[model samples]
Target chain A: MKQRLSTLMVAAVMTASFAAHAQQPAKKAPPPAKAAAPAKKEGITAEFEKFREVLEEDNPAELFEAKGEDIWKNKKGPGGATMAQCDLGLGAGVVKGAYVQMPRWFADVGQVMDAERRIVHCMVKYLGYKEEDIRKQPFSNDQRTPDHVSVITYVAAQSRNLKIAAPQKHAKEIEAYRIGKEIFAYRAGPYDFSCATCHGDDGKRIRTQDLPNLRKPAEAVKAYQGWPGYRMTGGFMLTQQWRMNDCFRQQRFPEPTYLSDSITALLAYMTVTANGQVYKGPGIKR
Target chain B: MADPMKIRAQMKGDTAEIRVLMSHAMETGQRKDNAGATVPAHFIQAITVDVGGKRVIQGQTSTSVSRNPVFGFKVKGAKVGDKVVIHWEDNKGDKRTDEAVIAA
Candidate 1:
């Protein structure tokens, strides 16, 4: 009888232990499956960054490349000549590998010319298009690229993968470079901000995007070379010249004239700083 | 025509892997211009993919899709030397069609 009672007691103890184990919910059986993916935020951020890198592999700037070629080949002015023979620092009829070396002193114009200004010179000298009308619009809208802007993207794309080597020769180029440094440091806008306010320090950021210090050569290459790019946010294809005008506007200063000395000088600073990097644009921009 | 879409289709064993970069704004129309003008609603509504003239994929999209949309997908039973074609139509009635051949 004692043995029978002891056996029954042992069975009771076993059942109680089993019930207690099931009640705690601390074991890895059922609850762990639900907690398998706990680090949701980190996983998502890593995934999004990977996705962006993959998306940038094929840039959409080629669309403007086609349009720019067509515009260059077609006649626009009463002079009835295409811009095929207009000089862009590398001599007439040379569109390839000329962009990375521009913002240089042009003996004909007697000033350094960026892509837009050089194209304007060609429009005037070869195509006989009025300079005033060309400057009337320096940016593109929803429908079409302004002639000069399209030409800039086209020329820049041709120079892609070539080293950026804008010359610092000529007394005028040296003077422009000096003035560009002054402008980058000058702080007299309503907000008392210059390009230095945000870009003076490396690793500084406005929001989620990191602002590349244009003063630093390594970062300047990353920032300056990829312009005339298609900006996804504004749904606009922007030129480097347009970007200069907008930067001043953001600081509440009078906007810089398109391809003006003020604008070109700042670009000269960036170009000189980025002397050896290869051009890899028109790049995709946020 | 606008620039042709950049596409790559590669055949691996029995499947075809394709990647495409399309030039489009995919504008949601919820934004405004610098002049405070209301940007109109314009976006791609549909995309279709075909293998050697046989339709393989048809996708629908909205403003949720980002601008300059990049897309990728896989197809079964593909071999080298087959042609892959892709086309997309936007709400504004603009369409672009481009094709690539599957390379081994």
Candidate 2:
């Protein structure tokens, strides 16, 4: 009888331990099949990564960077001087590391200018390159010559690997930053869209494309490097001017004048808000 | 605009990929009326594609082509590593030409 009781107790204990183990979910068990469906349906991140990989090779911006270098050095404007002599806020004649410091205030220029606007000033003053003409012919047939797009690429390329250091030293710089933040958040368009509409948050997309939150540092850096990119959709190589122009049109807003202060302000916002990020341009885009 | 337009092309196997980025506003003509007069008809008339030196695709397009238009397509037998050339012209005698390389 004693032996039988001991056997029974051992059996019961084993059963209880087994039951407890089953009750505690196994850590390595395949996740319930039902949970997989919802995860698969919300496949935003995976899609974005695939699309980005497609653009990894042979970015067309290399061409623009090459041309921009020529425009920077070659003397062509009415002034018959090379833009190499102009100041990009790294002091006169310094092109290195100037791009990442832009959207900052310049006491001499008396306004906050982004990379493109500053390039325009240099072209006009030092190179005698007329602003009107350059703006009108954003893309020149003379692929051999440096056009506005090429110059932008060149300047932006120079700042590659440099951190965004848009100076907040001047009062005007602060003012521009404030205005830029408002503009970014301000929504008024046919679609009631703002820059925030597409880029205000994380994990948003247009079709298979990823839309980065401009408010985030990593995302901003990833995007800021791609302006002045060659858009496969627009055959002509385009600069920031063309990019902003298209954005406004897509928003169904009236055309902003080329190189207008409003656009400049927007650029200021994009650059400064992208503080500590590097500038990479003439990137190839879809 | 000395040369009205130009196109160059190439082709590969099993795909007829082409790239066309044209220079035209592709104005929809439905835009506002100065004096309420409707804007006249203005649009791209045709686009031709050549792959590896053979005409593969020809399309008739309208003003709906975006400004500085661009297009991509795949066709039979166009292989990877082929060069695709495209040409486009408008009713107004404006034209443009561009090319791209094919990849699988």
Top candidate on DockQ is: 1
* Local accuracy of candidate 1 as per-residue lDDT tens digits, B1-104: 44567788897666677777777766679878778988898888988888766777777878766666667667776668878889999999999999899999
Give the winner by TM-score: 1
lDDT of 2 by residue, A1-286 (tens): 3322111111111111111323334333355653676656344444334333433333445545655676778757664677867788988878888888887677786888887888888777877767777766654331222366677777877877788888878888878877877877888987998888888999887777777788887887767776776665533466676667777887787878877787777767777778877655546666
Candidate 2 Cα outliers beyond 4 Å, as residue runs: A1-55, A139-146, B1-104
Clashes (backbone N, CA, C under 3 Å), per candidate, total 0, 18
Weakest lDDT window of 10 consecutive positions for candidate 2 chain A: A7-16
Candidate 1 wrongly placed segments (more than 4 Å): A1-51, A74-79, A127-130, B1-3, B11-15, B24-43, B90-94
Query: What is the fnat of model 1 with respect to the true interface contacts?
Result: 0.10
Model 2 vs. true fold: TM: 0.60
Candidate 2, TM-score of its B chain: 0.66
Tell me model 2's lDDT, rounded to 2 decimals: 0.63
